[model samples]
Target: MTPISSLANPTIKHAAALLTQHRIRKKSGQTVLEGVHLIEAAIKQNFTIKQIIIGQSALSHPEVAGLIEQIAQSIILATDAVYKQIRSLGTGVDIMAIVEIPTPALGVITSDCLILDGLQDLGNIGTLLRTASAVGISTIISTTGTAHLWSPKCLRAGMGAHFSLAIFEQVDYEAILQKVKIPLYATSSHTDKVIYQHNLTQPIAWVLGHEGQGVSEIFLRTATAIALPQPNGQESLNVGVAGSVCFYEMLRQRQFAQH
Candidate 1:
């Protein structure tokens, strides 16, 4: 295909708009993946890549070339000027792919999962996702107040974890509480019960709260409270760190049981 150099090109404009506008993404159920690694990860996970765009400068990169050969859709070559608008500066991003966001078939709400409750920081959301996947938590649910699960910032910070796991975003907190099969555990700075004392082996749904407000009172009222002991006198841990600690503890407990 001829190299697309015009900013007015329809495909080019659509891709740029998708990167910046949440409404467009939500309406179309699509998202952008920047860089070769994410594209490769999506392909490995069998995500439907609608199209792949490669900068003229990166056309010869083996990674880009390999992606072109593997993807069975449009692979557009673009001038650096046009490509520059598509990738964030300093990311060394020479390729980007437009992909359809898969609707998670939440067949059953299983325990041993993490539910993000009103978490606002996109980076923290992404980090929690990566941590959840690391601990073998396959299903994640993000309530209405949480950041967009497929937002570019979250997608980038997730480092390909998004494609490997099942995520249900914009979920109703109350709806889940009504239907969840296992205990819902929420962390608190003031709780008397420490996480270590909790039975981690039993399938449980971990409810991570907002960074500033902690979990919503709705969750606090319905969920069991677990505390993280901070000997350093820190007022609180970052939500991402606190959530990871809980996940690792759960992993440790489950591993010990297998032994």
Candidate 2:
């Protein structure tokens, strides 16, 4: 099969738009998965892959070739130049897939869940998602001001964690707070209560906020405020780092209690 060499090709343009524009992804209910790892994760989760595009040179790669063998339909080939047009910067990925975004319905918060309150950085958002999944947290909710979870940058940062968890985006904090039956905790540098002082074994909701602004006032006022206990005289920790610490603490407590 001849590789698609033109940037004006409809499939190339559509994939490019999906990668660069959140509005196109939202409207089309699809997102682009770059690299073999993300595509593998999507396949493992049984996500509907609409199309696959491979760079001509990547066809020789064992992993890429192996993936190609698994999916028998909807494959398209592109020249290296055309692939470069759609791939993310600094990434040498040669394969990508347009897959339908999973829309998981929010159910009862029976286990530990994470609430993202206005976190704007895609890297931070994605890191927290990866951390949450690593700690076995199954659900995550993002408030209106949070960055798009499925965006290319976020997805790349997440490294396929998006497929393993139930993610709710653009949620209303007030409404979601009402639905959460478990104890709610929020991180605050000003709080005297350190994270280790709290009992985290039980199901709870962790509210992590923006990098600069911190958690929203509603969360600070309503949720139990706790700090990470930085003794180095630092003003604060990165939101992703802070949240990961909290998530692991919860996991530790639960594991200890299980014995």
Candidate 3:
């Protein structure tokens, strides 16, 4: 097959737009997945892959070649120059796919879950997702002000954790407060209650908030506030670090209870 060498090609343009524009991704109900690992994760999770684009030079890579063999559908090949034009995350990514975004239905929170309230940093958003997934948190809800979960930077930072979790984005704060059946917990510097002392053995929803301003007042008012003990007297921890500590503590408590 002749490689698509032109940057002006419709397929190239579409992928570029999906990578750069949040509106385009939302309207199309699709997003671009870059690199071999993310595509592999998407396939493992049975996500619908609309199209695959491979750089011509990457065809010889064993992993890339192996992936190509596993995929039964026709793939578009692009010259190195063409692929470079559309690549978003930087160098060394020669494979990408246009996939339908998974819209997981949010039901009753019967297990550990996460609530991202106005968290704006893409890296923090991704880190929380990864940590939550690691600690076996199956569901995550992102309020309107949070960063886009499927954005290229977030997706890259997540390292395929997105595939393993049911993430609901752009949800209303009030809706979640009313809908979640489990206890809501938030971490705060002002709170006298420490995380280790809290009862985290039962099913609960962790509400993580903005990096600077912290959790929203509405959520804080509704949630049981717990603070991680800082002996050195640091002002506050990054949201990602704080959330990871909380998730693991919950996991540890549940594991101990199981014994």
Candidate 4:
């Protein structure tokens, strides 16, 4: 029942800065989740919740109602107008939470892996992680060049995927080298080895590279490059789509061989 109406409120200003500026989030060691789905996902994933800012209007929603009754975290009550003032920049999301995500380590997360070399699009990277987890790829290690997995855009695009798996962001190739012992494969348009030609039954790291630059020389130095057969003139598979194909293919092989 606490009405926070002042933009000058320290917590409100901090949240506004977090939503508007990336540096502010990193500086403060926190992130903002605007939609109820995203906030609940963070909660399910056990991310540290520092502030739960709810719109007075949102109290009627079932998700918000459930969260208020079950969660012991701090809560901030704001008028609907005040809530909208700090809502995410163009998203129309009415609820928001500030949660702390762990700074990721630079190594192999699990046996089946998805290694992102330099993907920049937060949405693409996030969806890939979501798809990866769905196919039972348990761990993902992203190079420093990719979008931050904990960023709001990536988190939303992930659609709660992080709740079920280990994600390491801001990692380096040297770290990957030490962690992944099984074969590492990279996705490309010009590879000589088609996906079916390779045996994916073995544990492998499917490395999808930069958006336009493709995989790196450093990764290429060690990875066996892989490509989807394109009989038509399709230029390249979108990285997220490409990774999805690779993950399911790996699943198909593993599941079939297991039987």
What is candidate 1's lDDT per residue for 173-219, written digit by digit as tens?
66777667788899987688898898888888999988999898888
Tens-digit lDDT string for candidate 4 (84-190) = 88876454546788888676565544477888888999889888989998988878888877777778888778888976878777777787888787788998766
User: Per-prediction count of colliding residue pairs?
Assistant: 0, 0, 0, 0
**Superior by TM-score: candidate 1 or candidate 4:** 1
Q: On a 0 to 100 scale, what is the lDDT of residue 87 in model 2?
A: 83
Give the distance in Å from residue 32's predicted Cα in candidate 3 to where it truly belongs: 0.9
Using lDDT as the yardstick, the better of models 2 and 4 is: 2
Number of colliding residue pairs in model 2: 0
Model 3 TM-score is 0.96
**Deviation from truth (RMSD, Å), model 2:** 1.6
Stretch of 10 with least lDDT, candidate 4: 101-110
The alpha-carbon lDDT assigned to residue 34 of candidate 4 equals 77
Candidate 4 Cα deviation (angstroms), residue 156: 0.7
Please list the residue runs of candidate 1 whose C-alpha ends up more than 4 Å from where it truly belongs after superposition: 89-93, 105-107, 257-259
Winner by TM-score: 3
Give the per-residue lDDT digits (tens) of candidate 2, residues 1-259.
8999999999999999999999999999998999999999988988888999999998889999889888866999999988987788555659999988777666667678999999899999889999999999879998998889999889989999999989988888777877778888999977798999999878889999989998899878888999999888899999999999999888888786545
The lowest-lDDT stretch of 10 consecutive residues in candidate 3 is 103-112
Poorest 10 consecutive residues of model 1 by lDDT?
Answer: 104-113
**Which residue pairs clash in candidate 1?**
none
